[model samples]
Target: MMAATKRIALGAVVTALIAGLAGCSGLGTGGAGSAPGAGKESAPGAEGNSPAAAPKGAVNLIGDGSTAFTGAQPELPRAKRLKPGQKPPQFVVFSWDGAGEDSQKLFSHFRAVAKKYDAKMTYFLSGVYLLPEEKKELYNPPQHAAGRSDIGFNDTEGIRQTLAELRAAWLDGNEIGTHFNGHFCGPDGGVGTWSVEEWKSEISQAKAFVKSWKTNTPALKGEGPLPFDYDKELIGARTPCLEGQKNMVAAARTMGFRYDSSGVGNQVWPTKKDGIWDLPLQLVPVPGRAFETLSMDYNFMFNQSGTTQGDPDKHEYWGNQMRDGLLQAFDRAYSGNRAPLIIGNHFESWNGGTYMRAIEETIKTVCTKRDVQCVSFRQLADWLDAQDPATLARLGTLKVGQKPKPGWTAFLAGTAPGKAAVGPVPARPADQPAGKGPDGSGD
Candidate 1:
């Protein structure tokens, strides 16, 4: 059981084994029932996930027609630099690992939730989710057998449903990122031990799975290809179990990846490491608990029941704890330093599906609030790129839960004493690395 596993310290928080246990694979039955506020029409004219609408321009198919070159993706928001002395918006990223549609239909369910709230998210797709079980040998995971995948491969039906969701998600302005393949963890032959070259191989294979799904799954060959060219669409990823980040970032930076969410950090502004944004999962309040945990369902579960299926009697309490913890994290960032809140989750029904309910409630509450921008990691990176380097450096100086003492107007205006006048870019925290928070187990 996960409860019996040894714990690892992540800054002030302690987390359990970094295994891919939370996103364990299985194609179960039944669709996800309507989430709270499901029937509400999408905000204004936001596009719902009705079906894959034809691209605005020509559809030039790529390899095996698994993906295509659809013209500029619809509804992608442009990133604008903040006006001088203007306070930043409260950015919240709701991301998923091993994203796919199985019996629970979570991929489609959350797509509706995002549209209803006029929000965009990052779906870290596990490549094996699109690779059929019979074709598992096509994957060549470093240090592991060719056909071996910790989370297992998918069936043709599963692949078809997942592909449909991916197509609609991209067209809806959501970002489709990779979660790599083979949820391998631990010290032996795990991602944490793989070399930089091996990590690159794993990444390429992950992209290949998405690029050639049609050829791998013959039954789905005639289906419409994924709307966007995956090579360009995929610019970020979260490693399984949040391990192997040091080498992963090195390899990803060379591959044109702009950011990575494979590490743990405090609830402060993000900084770049090795030329890539190190946007990590953060430590948030745990409600009544004395210590905080990573802002992820798996960590909450580990500390609460210490098992995926905990005592049914306390399910509601556990769910409330997670929801409140995340909201608490949001409030501080929203009201304090105004740093972006990066959150991670999985398509799971753990603990009687309580976590799912908590996440939906969190989304409904925060995404609709004033000055809050519930966006994907890709969008956050874009916004970050648009900011003046000096301004970003100033923002990083604000500690966790610490607001600007001089107020946003004077502080950001470069009028405060001892603050640089938004000219030269100073060294960012990413250059002098800090202690990373604990890695959450599973996806």
Candidate 2:
């Protein structure tokens, strides 16, 4: 069994190393930036229903030539308003935190999976991953010393690999969002204590790293720029360990952000938080266990193995438990309220890589189902924006696992009782904090 003391020490080291970084001027990427379909008109032949053909347009290089405008991204589904009485399509957002390509090759591997399964996902790239360790001093975190990152920095080859994956992922209709830089969590100058301004600084640095990778990793300066303008592509993010959301949201609202997934919430239709769509991680069953936990791999591992590495013999069982639990959650939403199932994951191979297996299985099982749209958070947000406000309000009334009692036609035909002239649904009260595990260590 993994020792608790060792876990604690590791957590401390990670937290201490991940102090926030400083921002720099120039064309920077946006934090969890908005994806396409946020009210932008689609180009001809870019129907938004299917992935477009190879980007057809002159590649207009942006600042530092690290990213470019290659035209509307391919493979984005068109956001259409629901027909009268139409049952809303079930949306499942499979998003990765701190997305990067490393020796594990999970990023590229999943890109293939998404293509095979006809799904698109969101990749929240950590800024420091692109900033080589040699140029680490370029990062000046909010409260921590310069040149320090909990997750450390990447090498030129690592940056090149990550950039390639990012380029391909975006071309495949995936979103390139920011997980920010340094990943500072907990108290004591962690992200939780950051002011709105501090959050802004961190966000700026996150974008700067992406926009300036060509300058930082000079060895790979010949790399083609990332296809989309990150400032326009990023419109959302989940905070580090889900901390400091209050200030982060306040800062994000003004920084072109459209949504945030940094909170713990129920498996219900999402509502706006301070004008930003609050797409949070949901609570899902724990299989045989009576209680539910956040729909994340780390939470399940925390509840089962209690560490990144657990009993080898039980790895298969643990994997199945997580798979079954996620499927249960999917079934609940699929057959009932049809709330968009928001699932989060990391690329780490913790617990013998069982969670990765479970996630892949879950994707294979769910993405191919009829009427199920496995999409990125940006796509979900776009679909949400295309709906009639009253219809969405009516849909929100159904509780978790509670289907429309009167059938879809009647339930959403008109406004429900007591909800006159459906406007933006007021933000629901916060649910259990989902970012941290039982012991407060989570991805």
Q: Report the C-alpha lDDT of model 2 over 1-443, residue by residue, as the tens digit.
A: 11111111122101111111111111112211122110123211112433233457678899999998877777665778878788888888999988877767777888999888888899988999899889999999999999977677777767877888899998888888888988776666778899999999999999999999999888888888988788888889988777788999999999999899987777889999999999997777665553566778877777777667787877777788778778878987888789999998887677888999999999999988888888888888888877888788888876767777667776677644544222232222122222333333422
lDDT of 1 by residue, 112-229 (tens): 9999898899999989988888999999999998999877788887788888889889889899999899888778787889999999999999999999998999988889999888
Tell me the spans in candidate 2 whose CA falls farther than 4 Å from its real position: 1-57, 415-443
Task: After the best TM-score superposition of candidate 1, give how far the Cα of residue 433 lies from its true spot, in angstroms.
Answer: 32
- Number of clashes in every candidate structure? 1, 22
User: Which is the leading candidate under TM-score?
Assistant: 1
Candidate 2's error at 376, in angstroms? 0.3
lDDT of 2: 0.75
**Candidate 2: worst 10 consecutive residues by lDDT?**
18-27
Count clashing pairs, candidate 1. 1
Predicted candidate 2, C-alpha RMSD: 9.4
Q: What C-alpha root-mean-square deviation, in Å, does candidate 1 show against the real structure?
A: 7.6
